[model samples]
Target: MAEVRGRDTWTEELASLIEDSGVRYGGDSPPTSFEVHAPQSESGESLKEQALGFVMAWCEILMELGRGFRDILRQNLINEDSYVVRKFGGPCSKVSKRLRFLNDFLPEDRDPFHAWSVVFFVFILALAAISVDPNREAVAPVVKVRQHPPSASRVLLPDGRYMAYHEQGVLADTARFSLVAPHSFLSSRLAGLPGVKASLLEEYGIRLVTYDLPGFGESDPHPNRNLNSSAMDVLHLVNAVNVTDKFWILCHSSGCIHAWASLRYIPEKIAGAAMLAPMINPYDPHMTKEEMKRTWEKWLPRRKMMYSLARRFPKLLSFFYRKSFLPEQHDEIDKLLSVSPGKKDKLVTEEPEFEEFWQRDVEESVRQGNIRPFIEEAVLQVSNWGFDIKELHVQKKCQTRGILLWLKSMYSQAGCELAGFLGLKHIWQGLDDRVVPPSMMEYIERVLPEAVIHKLPNEGHFSYFYLCDQCHRQIFTTLFGTPQGPVERQEETATAFEEEDKEEVLQVPV
Candidate 1:
């Protein structure tokens, strides 16, 4: 006679179920229990109860095996579609076919344990075969990820060219006006500095507008654009945006040329102008020996070399630019941010704000794969500027009172007066600048002797960006009154001004 076990005995029997199932599906087998039990009774009731317990434990084992097979099949499918699988023929497809065949053979009947076991065994053999295949290679799945959108907008000009621009500050009737001409290799977005933005709105109630020159940023390439034509484009931009009031022009480095052109072509439209570490026209015959020496030896040797190359072989220079600076590799930007020997250069590199601004400026400048505008601007800088700086003399008999009244109307103030002379020019230069040598100041002084000049002996060419707050204070104070009251905090937004009615007549300065 044999003894019959209770439900508690089934718990001990099910202990090996999980471990043995793992072994069958490619894991190590667990130790077997050595406890011996008395034989079960031969009566039908006892035998049926034993069979039912064994079937319940077998069902649990099948579930574990099913999970393992599902994971393996998923991995196989991913590998089958991978690059390595496409490049080198592999056994991934064969393994998948075997898995499908095994799944198809699985019975949907009352007792599925034996049939599932056969499928599990076949799966193990298939995996082993795949591992031993000579041409097989491990491959991972490919995933697609999206990138963030750009922070700038493009405006299609009347000439079918696109201009990229950024705007900040409040738009109102009394808003002061500023048109920023950024330095070489800098897009208009460079004007999006926190300090500059704060100072413009808080100090003077001004709106700061900056845009990329043709061939830079998203602006289309205007291969034949001269300094004067570029000024016309800016004027076109001003009218397109409905800026009826006279606006101040601010420039840095080589941007002075554009500012100077604006003053010459549209003198009546300008309230005042300021230039920082401004570059003098290199082609000017009156450039002193000292100026030429500093420009060639100290200030812009690399630019001179590149300009020479660009003038002779533009396409070659374009190829070099694309390979070097066009991509988002950050090599050129890193160089700009790295420590430099010059005081101003080092200052700009160390200042985190300027570093961030410069990096974004360079990136946006080449956003559209148009390095041609930069190259063209470079070539133009070293070449004739198509105008004489001496010919830009102030007209003494001009209606200064009428201009003052117009300014008052724009500012919505009764007695707002011009801070300095009607056509005042301010030139701010850093003595320690290596990019645009301080010697260039002598040329400017010689030509515009009456112009107000601020010489910072310890600063560098990038002093404008590093010392933006101080520069803004000096510039705004000279143009308007001193900044007062609490700093106005406003969210900076971008605006795109499109070309309006073609028949709208534009006033041209005679």
Candidate 2:
């Protein structure tokens, strides 16, 4: 019984193979019971890779066969006269003088047989035609690629002080875009997205534009600016670039909100948008008072206050903030201070020292005018937006649109994170985020009942590049309805993870 059970299991596994292949045998078809086996199951990979590889290998074999056939024909031609002569023109008069026609004689010159030359010439012509041309046709190269240079630029936004932005990943070299950076600890982290966008364009043609937000890069400290002004920075860039049509928008981290804000002010100008690690609201409603205070104390620097109060107490305050308090909170403060005001800003990561950069910009703004009030107002607006801004989650929508909502390690509130995108199909959220708790994601999922969720296991807040590859495909698919390559595998999965090409998107989600 035990042996029979094992045999039955193997036979059952072969059933589908028999059905698909119509099991055959020597000179006859098999009975219904004949068990044909399918190809062995290896790792749990999608069928796409296997199919492409098979086709590629088969084409290679055909190429080889064509080369081999050409070599055989060349040799056969060179030896043809000699072979015929050796076989038939030996000293044997009884064989008849006509044998010379089939032996060592070229068609016209030797005239082995005057009457039969036409037939022999026709036969040779047919053999050469059949051997060379058809084989060459079978192996002719088919695939071709063309290169187009990108006229991309990274722009600086003045509204929020000095935020970094650039345009990239354009299909035609002519298409342009406005890409916004996410909030994070380092300017480089914000710049990372542009780098990824550039790389993605290299493989898949797409064009975009980007810059840092106020207080993030070379810009002045972002004074108080409403969502409209924040979004208008992009429009201002479009004016600078002199583009007048609907352009694609790539928003990361808190930038999503600004992108959304643009929809109201510049709706007709937007082609599509990609929101990665987007925070529905910049203010985290879930945080307790203690948490908010801690976040502020950890992120806001004294030097920033010096810029704010520098006018009334310029010498004294700048000295104190720059020399003492600001230096103390410099590193962590830079991270928090760089946060973007809208949804889907970039992720936080190790940053270079920002004191020199910030101070230079602060001094420049001070020389230009009172950039402090603008900076202060921007902070106040972000701190206290109307309608319980912290509690409200931004959702996504469009009658016909493409959306990619990539959650980061710190993104805990799931349903609220993307509750706005009611009809979005391609939704991917990192599962093993050390920053945002899994419970938060679960709750978010419950709220977004219909959205498909992709759980990224070995990722974190800064793994933007890792997540960006999937987002890249999803974006192209949405805008052009292109098919996805293959599902990304979970990390550390022994089965097939090692084989996947780890071309981290420039904005690998942490």
C-alpha lDDT of all candidate models, in order: 0.63, 0.44
TM-score per prediction, in order, is 0.57, 0.38
Question: lDDT (0-100) at residue 485 of candidate 2?
Answer: 18
Instruction: List runs of model 2 lying over 4 Å from the truth.
Output: 1-165, 169-173, 176-194, 197-199, 220-223, 263-265, 282-382, 386-427, 434-454, 466-510
The sequence of per-residue lDDT tens digits that candidate 1 reaches over residues 391-510 is 664423322378766665665645543322357788888888777777788777777777888888787766664547776666777767765422232212111122232223344334
Q: How many residue pairs clash in model 1? A: 0
Candidate 2's C-alpha lDDT?
0.44
Error of 1 at 138 (Å): 32
On TM-score, the leading prediction is: 1
The CA lDDT at 50 in model 1 is 90
Range of the 10 consecutive residues with the lowest summed lDDT in candidate 1: 489-498
Tell me the deviation in Å of residue 142 in model 2. Answer: 55
lDDT of 2 by residue, 1-510 (tens): 776666566555665565555443332223345545545452235377788899999999999999899887667743547575557546445445635534543545655555467767996897578556655434423221222232224455544334444444443323433333333222322343432545545434344455545544434445456666766776777766656666665554445556556654665566555544443332446545554444344223442343334333334433333332223123332333432211121232322323343333333222322333333433433443333322223453222222333332234334333423222323344443432333433443454455345565655434543335665655555554643212221123534444444544434787
